[model samples]
Target: MSHPWFARPRPRVLAHRGLLPADADGIAENSFAAVAAAHAAGAAYVESDCHLTSDGEVVLFHDADLSRVTGDPRPVAEVPLVELERLMGARGGLITLRQALEAFPDLRFNLDVKAQAAAVPVGRIVARHAERVLLASFSDARRRTALDAAERFGRGIRPATSAGTATIGRTLSALAVRSMPLVRRALAGVDALQVPERQGRVRVVTPRLIEAAHACGVEVHVWTVNDAPHMTRLLDLGVDGIVTDRADVALRLVAERR
Candidate 1:
């Protein structure tokens, strides 16, 4: 028999753009096909980035503004969802928050909040299925709004948070090396701390760091890894979960171990 946490299959893979054809239309990152492919590929769960369009509609996207992914310039807050939908290429459709919920009813998702405006819609949508999802945001304020609204709506996800990626600034106070007061305090408020395997010029998720997070009853999940050795290493270090862009490779790794 396996221990409780150990029961989780090894190497959880979150498909990068839902195992897309790599050049297919609507199979690019953050598109419906990308999300759908993630679930169909046997991902334990899926992850997505979200930003609200000008019409207060939350569209699936990883960036604050749409210039890089979108061919032309358009501020996410300045354009409505309908307009965004019309301008989409392979990877650029506007997926409403409600559509994602109703579409993937049973799958667990890590919805990364990229805009403050998204908080209210996120909270309202998750309130519809609070037990089945996790809400996260780079903005603590946004996360807090979601949490607060969940309560107002009597959604059962008061403990869920919009956890940020941990960085050195995340782990250290302005004053000195010995002072991790700010980082610890930030972690204290979050149910989990999502950090990149590499954040900025530094590498986090050391053995000691993982131990420390677990000591605080917080799960540590590292993101966007595409290498087998690194995935294996994170598992060896006993990370609570691993997020990856190459869900195909990650899923295969998980099945072999299971």
Candidate 2:
């Protein structure tokens, strides 16, 4: 059986940083308003980032430093949550992971662990609500460490996870050689393979790769897709999920098809 995280509708619309489009006037990514916007637009899942504040609070802010988002040259871990909140107040208010879970009870979340300090805290927090959470990271070690922490919490069921960069590389390598055994081994603990439609010059999502993943009961999710034509192309390519910055548009397009 597929994990509960995959039990939702296929061609899942995972709102990247909560549907904050590049031209969005006021809302900020990973903020409470962003999440609310995604939910209000009929998105069932929201993809977000998590980092730890200096005061040790786990909040949803993407960058390691606040320079781009807040124009403060300090790292996120050096800023207190109160200061973080104040900075985001005008944009869309800082939102903690816990507050998001509580505020949007019906929505599922795809959480990318962005900081080392946030791994354990994220695991512990998501443990109580594992059914709707998918934990991920760019680092395989960090991903496993967070999973291990969740296991330590005695939740009985670990949250679903996507393959990290290392695992994705290994899987792609195995698939290129047509080594099904190696592919299975690489995807052992992962529930999904979240990847870009293309990485530089190499096309990442091919029919062969998608077939191989589905053969092993793993779903393929492509990320950061924004355009409708690309979204339609990917859906035609048989991907199971689309992580996008334009969730509002994606939702409408998907619904129109249905």
- Candidate 1 structure quality by residue, lDDT tens digits, 1-258: 221222335444555434564555544577777777777777756778777777777777877777877766767888877777876744635566677778887666677777777877777766756665567776666777876776677544453553653333455331135444554665665656677877687666677666656665667778778888888788878887777877777777666666
Error of 2 at 75 (Å): 0.4
Candidate 1 RMSD to the correct structure: 4.1
Number of clashes in model 1? 2
* TM-score list, all predictions: 0.83, 0.97
TM-score of 2: 0.97
Question: What tens digits encode model 2's per-residue C-alpha lDDT throughout 1-258?
Answer: 677877877889999999775566877899898999899888999999999999988999899999999889999999999999999999988999999999999999999999988999999888888888999999988888888887788468888999999999999999989999999999998899999988999999999989999988889999889999999999999999999999989999999988
Model 1 ranges off by over 4 Å: 1-11, 23-26, 89-93, 165-186
